[model samples]
Target: MNDFYSVTAQPSRPMGGRRGVFRPGHVQLPVSGVTPNVETHVAIAGDWHSSGYWARQALKMLQEQAPGVRTLLHLGDFNLTANVPWSAYRRNVVEAMTASGLERIFVTPGNHDDWGQLGPRFQAHPNEPYRLPKTQTIAFLPRGYRFTVGGRTFLSLGGAASPDQGKRIEGKDWWRTEEPAEADAARALAGGSADVMLTHEAISGGSRLVDDVIARPNHRLFDERGLDASRRSRAIVTDVWTQLSPARLFHGHMHVRAEGHHSAGRSVYSLAANNSPGNIGVLDLRDLTWAWLD
Candidate 1:
């Protein structure tokens, strides 16, 4: 395991990003605080699907677009395929992030992601954020994970149902752990509320785009069981949204950019996949304002 993390183990912090103290162990999922600022901003990224090339491009663009931003809240689909070069991916991503002036890219896993690799890590540290075992530069946010920055609270619940399971082989490219369990929702609901919610699956009935996607007609290619599971997963997301009531909710998986808002401050946005327009966004943590960087 002579990866980048191993090589940089000397004097490296136990975690990748700036670590902070949290509420006493009595509180569940207590969030650690970031260095607050008057205008703290972070990059909101869409699905990378585990493409190291896209990973590099996104970081480079972040440097070009938002040079001062040091964090990324990726909305899942960071798939890790067997074909990917884990070491090179780690090295290049770390280099690109450094060049881009980024601190850490927090990922919420998607349906296509290799959950088999992440499961044990999440189990080991279910109460807090943990560095992705092999590539410690990146952090994986467990379901119902919460954190705060610039006075705004953010919640990350990552996992989705793969409607195209017919095309993906289980244990190889697809995993049963893709869908969110009922307990995940309960854990997130227990957090009470958030100013922002980041998810991989669109919340059911939350956005017109999401509703239309679920109601579309030409999904004959997907199996009924997969569709049923997807509905259930979206229901879980919807339940969380209704319970937590985040002012802003953003997600990936539809790979289409569209947004719907009920009031001035409350909205649901869907981002397209990486390498496409609307894949990148800039969020002002101070006021919870959003700007599309593409």
Candidate 2:
């Protein structure tokens, strides 16, 4: 891959009509890809784990190797946003990414994004506490937007809370749920209208790693309620995935590249981030292929 953020736009395609504010650097239509441009490349990475070295190195590699990359995806866990005293390092990584001049930066917030210290804005409170680029639209965050990329509808769910967990944190009276946003996103995809769904947490069978290890100590969504809360989380998450269908899914959180192929249906690639060991996972957008940085 060449070190350039260039993709011959494919002819435009039919995108889901749902509209919201778009982030800067985000282009929803394939003014060119509507024709299905061949050999287009997009970059995917996740789980920074708050390590600046990983972010710096990942950006360097893209600058050198994937210069033609059309998109830069920082999947999630870019930093332990809750623990860091100040977000200088986090800002540095993102700003460095923008400096790369990739057309857009599509990100999903991870549990660590909460910065437990910052309060609910980290949890998608309409208040918008995080420092988003003045140019970007925080997806699914209160009033974020959705757009298509490379023949696929990339539905970015705002940082969300597990319904059960929200009830616990906000108390039953305060728990306001949208019946589960993943299902809503999935249904839009199932309509065969969208190509891919992007979110911070894995929905039901969306990703192998999230399904198998979400409970691990290292996995952010593991319920603070412990083993006993297992029922609550699954009941809320699984129902949504079951009701909706999605062609492909990508996620970060476990910080490992786990490839999932299901006889049940579509294939999903769970990506890890730059801070995890060797670097982050990178996917070839043309054929939906992916490989982890060794």
Maximum-lDDT candidate: 1
Model 1 residue 250 CA deviation (Å) reads: 1.0
Write model 2 residue lDDT over 163-251, tens digit each, in one string.
23533454321123322254434443344433455555555565656677654553343445433334333354344435444566666
- TM-score computed on alpha carbons, candidate 2: 0.62
**Superposed model 2: Cα runs more than 4 Å off:** 1-39, 79-81, 115-145, 158-193, 206-211, 214-243, 277-279
Residue 101 of candidate 1: its Cα lDDT?
66
Model 1, CA-based lDDT: 0.74
Residue-level lDDT of model 1, residues 1-294, one tens digit each, is 112111111121212243333211111112233332222566888887667788888888778777777668889887654457766766777788878867667887788777887767677766666565555557778898887654567888998998888777888877888899998998899889888999999887667876887788346678877888888999999899987678999999988888888765688989889788888888865456688876
lDDT agreement of model 2 with the native: 0.48
Worst 10 residues of 2 by lDDT: 30-39
lDDT per model vs. reference:
0.74, 0.48
